[model samples]
Target: MKNLIFSLPFFLTLFFGTHVNAQKISDGQTIEINGMSVTFNILNKESVEAGGKPYDRYKVSATVKNASDKGYNIRLSSYPQIVSNIGLVELNCINATGAKLTSKKIELKMKAQMINVSYSAYDKSGKFTTNMIPITGSYYFDPGDTISDNAIFIVPQGEKPDVSVRNLR
Candidate 1:
């Protein structure tokens, strides 16, 4: 009973704290990412569908749109990023063969790459719920492309998002 009492407060704080600090992200919020006009939308979901299949998961999806006239490359890990109020904790999923990050390459070609992403969803703790994920990932984005990919940790926790996707100059 004593242990429960002690842990109850901790659990409550973590639960309620998530709500208290979640910054409202408007739909189609345009921001400058990698020297491009990037529009993003965040979605809370119990599970995400990918590759014509579905699985159980708990995470947020940041539907990103590269509204630029150029292409950009982004790196994705084998797992999701743990984002708190402080910021996104490093969740680099790079390793060797047979690893989820083995093919960590994402290529974006304007509207061509805007097709629905076929990657599996995972927990924020870097656990994969499905096997349909990119290996050796390196994302390339072109101008005027809207891609709804759930491969990031957009949780504000209790602070503003401090993750910057700077363009390669």
Candidate 2:
């Protein structure tokens, strides 16, 4: 009886204090990344060369348009950044016969806040080009990886920015 009395308050708090289905919060407004009033235009993607060989690695790219009056810096980390916030961004290239081809790794990069960041993907050649797909790995943008950054540009209020991924031999 004593133990029940002691635990009653705890149980009550747990049962009553929690919300069953609270609505998610939203700002309804977009914020500039890395102090740059730029907008991402393209999330381009393609197959990439892996380990100096033409493998079935899918390459991912993102393009941002500067909308700020001054030069705006941007980086991959400023966005979802690989397999982090958005989980693994995956692309698949499969063959008709259901046979696996082969794949390799490719570098990715973005520049923001005056800093450059890079990322990489693995090759899955045996999977086939038709099924050649790329996704987010368990890694984020790091230094010395393939990356792209647009020069500081004075974007007018209505201009758009762009970014993309390329498939290279």
Once model 1 is optimally superposed onto the true structure by TM-score, how far is the C-alpha of residue 168 displaced, in angstroms?
Answer: 5.3
Candidate 2 per-residue C-alpha lDDT over 17-90 given as tens digits, one digit per residue, 9 for 90 to 100? 53321112111222234332222222332333434433222222223333434431223433446422311111
lDDT of each: 0.38, 0.29
Question: What does the lDDT come to for candidate 1?
Answer: 0.38
Candidate 1 segments whose C-alpha is farther than 4 A from its true place: 1-28, 45-58, 71-140, 151-164
**Per-residue C-alpha lDDT of model 1 across residues 1-169, encoded as one tens digit per residue:** 9999999989999877644433333344655545445334434434334444443222323334555566554554543543122111111112211122222211222221122346567778989865443333444555665554444332212322332232223
Candidate 1 accuracy as TM-score: 0.28
Best by TM-score: 1
- TM-scores, in order shown? 0.28, 0.17
